[model samples]
Target chain A: MIKVLFFAQIRDQLATSELRMPSSENHNIEMLLSNLKARDSHWQTVLSKTNLLVAVNQTISNENSALQSGDEVAFFPPVTGG
Target chain B: MIKVQTTDFNLQAEHDKLREKSSVGAVVTFSGLVRDINQGKEVSSLTLEHYPGMTEKSLTKIVEQAKSRWNIIDCTVIHRIGELKLSDQIVFVGIASLHRQDAFAACEFIMDYLKTEAPFWKKESTTDNESYWVDAREGDLKALNKWSK
Candidate 1:
């Protein structure tokens, strides 16, 4: 399974912090995002944000990054702390 | 040392610790405070959120980079989470080095990187009872760029 997490405003808007889904061959962040977007219009709207940031295995990553079983993924907004 | 905690930290203690090395001749410290006003709004309180594992990793990477670029003897970074009131201390960075220039440069370098790289978010509550997440500033991205050149 792939563990997906959300934080900050994205988490507040979605009201869902974590999710788990089965991993498949040739899976990547973009495909996972599309699967998530298919859940509902609200998910579609929030996940489609242009400024949204993603992380794979605790490192900053882009949508093209590949995923594997038991990998952790996160989605959130840009950081504002010092 | 890197610390991400909800409790307040003592500046003097951090300074003394950083200066413990006999070869250290300079210690520079930077602290960030919660402001009473932001973007024309009267802020009363602020709350911070962070990606647990990634926050530490990012900070360590930034400190490592600073060490590689400068002659740093020691460094300490402390970032506060949870709710904080106006004027409360939010973050602290201290660097020890053999000379003033290295300490000063490394201190600023860590702060600049932390502002852009660390996965931390701040939410502010205004005096009028309105609360919102603070937006990332363009100036912060610019600050990080200056170091790369």
Candidate 2:
């Protein structure tokens, strides 16, 4: 299983902080997000936003980044703090 | 030194600590405060949230980058989280070096990187009880880009 984290506006919008999901074959960030988007319309709207930021294992990541078992993934809005 | 704390910090104490090195000849400090207004909204307070482990890691990386790029003797960064009212101190960056130019440049670079790279989010509460998350400004990204060149 992989740990999925959310923060800031995305956390509020989805009303979730963290969850765990099973690792899948050929899993990558894009597949994880699309799987999440299929959960509901609200999730689709939030995950589909073009500006959403993602991190894999606490480092900035893109949709092309591959995922693995026990890897942590995070999603958040653009940072606005100094 | 890097600290992300809920309590307020003492600027003089932080400065004194940074300037303790005998080789240090110039010290530069910058503080950001919560303002009464933002984007035409009358802000009453700001709430800051940060990803715990990730925030520490990012801040450490930023400090390391500054040290690598400048001849800095010592440096300190303190960022306050949680509820902060108007005029409250939000962040502090202090750098001590052999020359003023290095201190100034490193301080600015750290701040610019912190604005975009750090995992911190701020929500502003208005006088009318309305609240909204602040959006990232394009100017901040451009500011960070300047350091890369």
Specify the highest-DockQ model's number: 1
CA shift of A18, model 2, Å? 0.9
Q: On residues B1-149, what C-alpha lDDT tens digit does candidate 2 reach at each position? A: 89999999888998999989799999999999999989899999999999888888899999999999999999898988999999999999999999999999999999999999999999999999999999999999999777878
Per-prediction TM-score to the true structure, in the order listed? 0.98, 0.97
RMSD of each: 0.9, 1.0
Error of 2 at B123 (Å): 0.4
Q: lDDT scores for all predictions?
A: 0.94, 0.93
Estimate how well candidate 1 is docked, as a DockQ score.
Answer: 0.89
Q: Which pairs clash in model 1?
A: none
lDDT tens digits, residues B13-119, model 1? 99999989899999999999999988889999999999999999999999999999999999999999999998899999999999999999999999999999899
Query: What digit string (tens of lDDT, one per residue) describes model 1 on residues A8-47?
Result: 9999999999989779832999999999998899999999
